[model samples]
Target chain A: MSTRLDFFIDRMVSQRACLDFGIAQTADMQGPVFELGLGNGRTYHHMQHNIKGRDLYVFERAVASHPDSTPPEELTILGDVRETLPAALTRFGATASLIHADLGGHNRAKNDAFAQLISPLVEPLLAVGGLMVSSDRMYFEALTEMPLPPEAVEGRCFIYRRDS
Target chain B: MSTRLDFFIDRMVSQRACLDFGIAQTADMQGPVFELGLGNGRTYHHMQHNIKGRDLYVFERAVASHPDSTPPEELTILGDVRETLPAALTRFGATASLIHADLGGHNRAKNDAFAQLISPLVEPLLAVGGLMVSSDRMYFEALTEMPLPPEAVEGRCFIYRRDS
Candidate 1:
C-alpha cells in the first residue's frame, strides 16, 4: 500500500475517538448514505457495523485491486469520485441523506472539485431533516472562504440538514 | 505568550490538518503521551484547538463552571485545560516532546487514570527511529490495542537522532 494510504488507515484505527464522535453525531439520522473518497472501505465498514440495513454508495478514485474478492453487499463501489459521483446519484435516483467525505488535507484541487460537485447536490440528496456530514478539514476550507460565520466551520464533520 | 506557547497557538489556527494528524499521534506512542478522558476543558478547547505544549494538562473530571476571575499565574486551575495544562506541567517540572489526547469521545476509566496521568512522563518519548505524521481514523484506533506489528506503523515527523 502507498504511504498515504497506510497513513490514512493507521489514522482510522488509532483515532477511534474522532470516528466514534462523527458516527454518534449522525447515528440517529436516516440513511441511503454516500461516502466520498472511500479508502480501502474501512469507514464504509465502520458505518455498516454501526448502522445496519442502510443502503451505502462508496465513491473511490480507483477501483479496489481485488474486486469480487470480498464484496460487501450493501456497498456499491463507484470508481473515481470526480467522474462517478453524478452517475452514482442518478443510479440511486435520489440525493444522499448522509454524504461523508474526507478528501480535504493534501489534494487541494481535487478536494475543491469534489466540494463543488457535491454542493449543488446537498439540498436535493438530503431528506427532510437528513444530514450531510463531511470531514472538517475539507469542508471547513470551502466554508471559510465563503462568507459564513465561525460557528459554521467548527467541527471535524459538518452536518447539513434538509428541511423539506 | 512564550514562543513555545505561540507555536502551539499558530498550529491550532492555521495547521489543523497537521495538528489533527501529526501532533495527536505523538501522545499515542508508548512514551509520555497518553489519551485523557472527557472533561469540560476538552469540550471547549483542547479537542477543538488541538493545542499541545509542555505546560498543558487536562482534568479528567468535569467542573460545573469557570471561576469569576482567573487565578494567579502560578496557581493552576483544574477545569480550564487550555490554561491549566501549561501551568500544571510547568509547575511539576514535567516536559513532553509530544502530547496527544482526544478527550472528546468515550471517556473510559483506563484511559483517564493510567494513560493520561502517567503517560506524559515516559522517557525518550518517541521510539528510536520512529516518525510522527498525521493519519486517518482506522489506523488511529488500531494502535490502542497492544502488540502492534512492526510493519503497521511508519512515517517520520521529527527524526530523533542522537549525536554519535
Candidate 2:
C-alpha cells in the first residue's frame, strides 16, 4: 500500500479497532464475510485467521504483496473486480453475506462509480442477514445537520439485508 | 412536532426511501421501527399506518404537535436527546437495531452533537447483527483524486481492514 493508502487504511483500522472493542463488549460474531478490493493480503490474513472457517473471498485489482502468503484454497485474488467479480462468483458458486468495501479515498468520482458498480453485486452476494461495511467519509464530507442528534459518521458501513 | 421537525423528518424519510431503492433495494414495509427525532408527527402519520408498529420519539426543544393524535403507547416525547436518550432506552426496554438520522440542514452544531451522542449507542442498541444505514452525502462533499485507479479503492477497504 502507498503512503496515502496506508494512511487511509490506518484510519480504517482504528475504526475497526473501535468496532472490535464494541463487538467484543457485545460479543456477537456471526458473519459469513466477503471483502472487496483486498490489497497485498494483509486484512485477508487477519480475518481468515480471526474468523476461522467463516468463508472468505478476496477480490483485488492487482496482486502485489503476499500473493503466495494467502491460503491458496480459501483465498481468491482477481485482477479486476469490475470484470472478474461476476466470473469469480460463478466459479466459486457462492455470493458473500458480508461485503466490506474500503475503496473510497481522495477520488470522489471513482469512489461513487465504484460504489454504483458493486452495488448491483451486493444484492445478489449479500445473504439475507448479511451487512456491507464502508466508511461514511467515502460517501459525504459531513453528516447532515438538520436531523439533530446526528448518527454514526466515521467508518460508516451500510448493512443491507435481502429481506427487512 | 413543529414545522421545523416535520421538515426534518420529511427529509429523513426521503433519504430512507432512496436507500430502499438505490441502495438496499428492499421493498418497504410496516414494522415496529423507531424514528429518533419524530418532528411534528407529520412524517409519523405518513408512515405510521404503513409500518406495523410505529414508534416515534421526539427530543425537540419545544412542544411536539398532535400529541393527542400520537398513539400514547407508541409515541414518546422528550425535551432533549442528551438528557433523555438513556432514559428513553430504558423506558422503551429495547435498543433500536435499525436507526435513521439525517444529521444535516439548519442545525449543524446540534446535528454534529447528536451524531456524537448516538455514535456510542449504535453498537449497544443495534441487534447483534442489525444494520445502521445513512446517506453518503452526509460525509463527503466529493471524492478525492488518488494515484491509483478507481478499482484501487476497493482493495483499500480490505487492506485497511487487515492493517488496522
**Which candidate comes out best when scored by DockQ?**
1
lDDT of 2 at A13: 46
Tens digit of per-residue lDDT, candidate 2, span B69-142? 35454355545555565665666544443444433334457656655665554324333223334321222112
CAPRI-wise, candidate 2 is incorrect
- Chain B TM-score, all predictions listed: 0.25, 0.50
lDDT of 2 by residue, A19-47 (tens): 23322322233445666765545445555
lDDT of 2: 0.43
List ranges where model 1 is wrong by over 4 Å.
Answer: A1-31, A64-74, A108-110, A136-155, B1-164
Best by lDDT: 2
Candidate 1's DockQ is 0.02
Docking class of 1: incorrect
lDDT of each: 0.41, 0.43
